[model samples]
Target: MAGKQVMLVGVDDSERSFYALQWTLDHFFHSPSASPFKLVVVHAKSIPISAISLGGPGAVDILSLVEKDLKSTAERVTEKTKEACKKKGVEVEVDVTEGDARNVMCDAVEKHHASVLVLGSHGYGVFKRAVLGSVSDYCSHHAHCSVMIVKKPMAKN
Candidate 1:
C-alpha cells in the first residue's frame, strides 16, 4: 500500500492543534516509501446569526455572511497547514468544511477514506470536560477511523 492513504489530521485554531499537526508530520512522514497520505486541516467556525443579521433582515443576506466567513476561515487554515507542511518537507492536500466541528470532522474522515484521525487533546480539567463534552472525546467515540489524541507536554521549569 505504498500509495494508499491512511490518516486525516483535524485542526482548529487552538494551540493544541498546532502541536498535533507538528507531531503528525514528524512521526508519519519520515518513511520515504510510506503511502502518500493526505492531511486535511479543517477549521469549523460557527457563524453567529447576530453577526450576519447586522447587514440585513433576510435569510439570503445572512447566508451570504455565513458563506463569506466560512471561506475566510478555510483559507486561513489552509495557509497555515501549507506552511506547516512546507516546514516539515511533506506534501499534503487540505480540505476545509463548515459545520459543527465534530460532525464535519467525522464526515471528512469518511469522505477521505482515512484509516486514522489525528487530533490534539485539549487539557481540560476533569470538571470542564465533564461539563462541556470535549471535542476530542466526541471524536474518540464517534469517528469511523482510529483516533490519535496528541497531548502537549507540560512545560518544565
Candidate 2:
C-alpha cells in the first residue's frame, strides 16, 4: 500500500467522465495481482456565481437553492463513482470540492502527490474548446503530474 503511487482521476456528471473512469479501471486495474496504483476520484462542484453576481431581489434565496442543487449533484456523482469502482473490486477515495474543475483537479494532484492524473476528453473542436475552456487541456499543461486523457470512441450511426 505504501509503495503504490497515487493515481488521481477528475470526474463530473458527464458521461465522458464516467467513460474515462471505466476505461482506466479496465486497462490499468485488470492485472491479476493488486493494481499498480492507488486510485482517487475527485468531483468538482461548481459554485453558483450567477446567483452571487445577480445581487438582485431574491438573490440570496436563489443562492441557497443553487447550493442545494450542487450538493445533490455531488452526491449523485460520487455514488456513481463508487459503483464504478465497485465493479473492478477496487478501493477508491472520493472527494467533492466546490470550485472550477480545472483548478480543483490540479489541486488534487498536488495534494495527493499523484503520479498521473486521468481525465475524459469531450473532443470539442478548436472553436468550441476555446469557448468552453477545456478542463483536460488546462490540467495537462498545468498539473504537476502526468495526465492521461481517455477519449471515448464515437458511436457510429
Please, what's the RMSD in Å of model 2?
A: 1.1
lDDT of 2 at 16: 96
TM-score of 2: 0.96
Question: What are the Cα lDDT values of the candidates?
Answer: 0.80, 0.93
RMSD of each: 3.2, 1.1
* Tens digit per residue, CA lDDT, model 1, 61-124: 6787777876776778778889988877776777767677888888888888888899898899
Candidate No. with top TM-score: 2
lDDT, candidate 2, equals 0.93
Give me the runs in candidate 2 sitting further than 4 Å from their true place. Answer: none
